[model samples]
Target: MPSALVFFTELSDAPSKAQRELLTLAASIGEPTVAVASEVPEAAVTQLGAYGVNKLLVAPANESSFLDHSLSALEAAVKESAAQVVVVANDNFSREVAARIAVRVDGSIVTDAIDISADLVVTKDELAGSYSAQAQASGGVLFVTLKPNSIEDTPQAQAVSVSVEELAVSAATAPSVRIMATEEKVASDRPKLTEARVVVAGGRGVNGDFSAVEALADALGGAVGASRAATDAGWISHDAQIGQTGVTVSPQLFISAGISGAIQQKAGMQTSKCIIAINKDVDAPVFEIADFGIVGDLDKVLPQAAEEIRRRQA
Candidate 1:
């Protein structure tokens, strides 16, 4: 089997759903090695083994917000493993790191990849999900940034003990900028907007209130999202915004409540497998692409839907 490297910057107690998906994909393609920017917790090591990762490479930790440490770690892992295929999370920072590594190693890179074959062919969506394209790099090394929820994470039949190795980062990789201070946002029980399999979003029609949207999202065990209008009106944080200028999500199901369904909003979630739009306007554009739509007041419609969902689950 060919050698593969997977990069994960966050050092959580265990692998996140997105990271598990990356590992699962890597295992399918080749012998998988995981690279992290910080020390791996015991729980994480155990979980990595469950995904068939025998090797865990740790990079020297640094305080730079520029992710220099992460880049150094990936660079060192590439050299140590000489992996033919490299997989990473599809995020802005990861893309930048992958790009730089591609240049350093003279490799080829593909972003937003949805699938990768054993032979290194990448399948991806393009032109706002209009085109499904397959691409292969013409080089010894192939780096790909995979989209979240693109693959399922299945554990190996048997778990193996993991071996940890620390990589030596070169001083030349130091960052030019340093973070002076940071503030952590309040944590939520809901899943991340970008990673959730189901998303419930609201817009200006909510009239600066998200209780109805939150109720439906919470009832379904999904994440809460917001349109640009809702965020700009101080109804929700910008982090919850979903649009061309905000975060993009391709979840299994998407619910749009009290939103006008403009083109900008579709640019972010047009790839969702199923879309349910709720609006009072029967002529709303969102209904054009929706698999299911309700022409009613979201305030009343959402709460009733949530109650029914809860009742069924109960």
Candidate 2:
């Protein structure tokens, strides 16, 4: 059978949902092996092994270690495992790491692949999720970064003896970029905007009242998002903004309230499995692409939707 490799972030007691998605994708493609540049927890090791990881390569870790510093260790793991395909999450960190690895391995690269077949063909969005195209590896090894929600992260643990090795990193392999400081974001119980299965976004129609957006998001167990206009108007943080200049998302469901659905905004979330737009303007651009469009007052529409969702769950 072909072998697949996955890279993971070293965070928490277990792999994050994004990392688990990589693991699941790897297992589906071939024999799965995982590489991490941090101290591996026994629980994490056990969990990954149970999820069909045949080997786990742990790179030496430091307080400020970054992905660039781990490239040498990762190169060694890829060579040793002889993996044909490598998988990672669709994020900036992974993209940088993949770019470096592609050069080192003389490999073909693809990012934000929405689907990958067992034959190694890749399918991803193009023209800002307006079209989908198929691609194949032309050289070296196959490397792919997957968008969140492209695969389910359910673990398929089996009783297997997974070989765990600690990779050595020589000082010569130090990264070019040195981190002077690190600032962590404030922790939140809510799902990450990019990774959430459902996202509820607000725009100028909210008139600075994000209460409806927050409540609807809370009811749906999703993350809150915002349009560039909303963020520029200071109704929400810029990080929550969804547009060409902000984070791109591919959630199972996206609810847009008051957003105009300009090309910039559509670039960020046009790939969502289901799109519902609520705008008072009958000819709002957002309604053109929405799977369901409602012409009404958003404050009233959102509250009612949230109530019904909660009542159904209850």
By TM-score, how accurate is candidate 2?
0.95
lDDT of 2 by residue, 1-314 (tens): 66898876574577777777887888888889888877888888777876788788888675554656567666776787788888877899888787788888899889989878888899999988888999998878888999999888867746566899877755544556677898998988889999999999999999999999999999999999999999999989999999899999989999999998999999999999999999999999999899999999998999999999999999
lDDT of each: 0.89, 0.86
Q: Which stretches of candidate 1 lie over 4 Å from their true place?
A: 64-66
Candidate 1 accuracy as TM-score:
0.96
Residue 240, candidate 1: Cα error in Å is: 1.2
Error of 1 at 312 (Å): 1.9
Residue-wise C-alpha lDDT for candidate 1, range 24-59, written one tens digit per residue:
999999779999877778888899999899899888
Q: Give one clash count per candidate, in the order shown.
A: 0, 1
| Displacement of the residue 241 alpha carbon in candidate 2, Å | 1.0
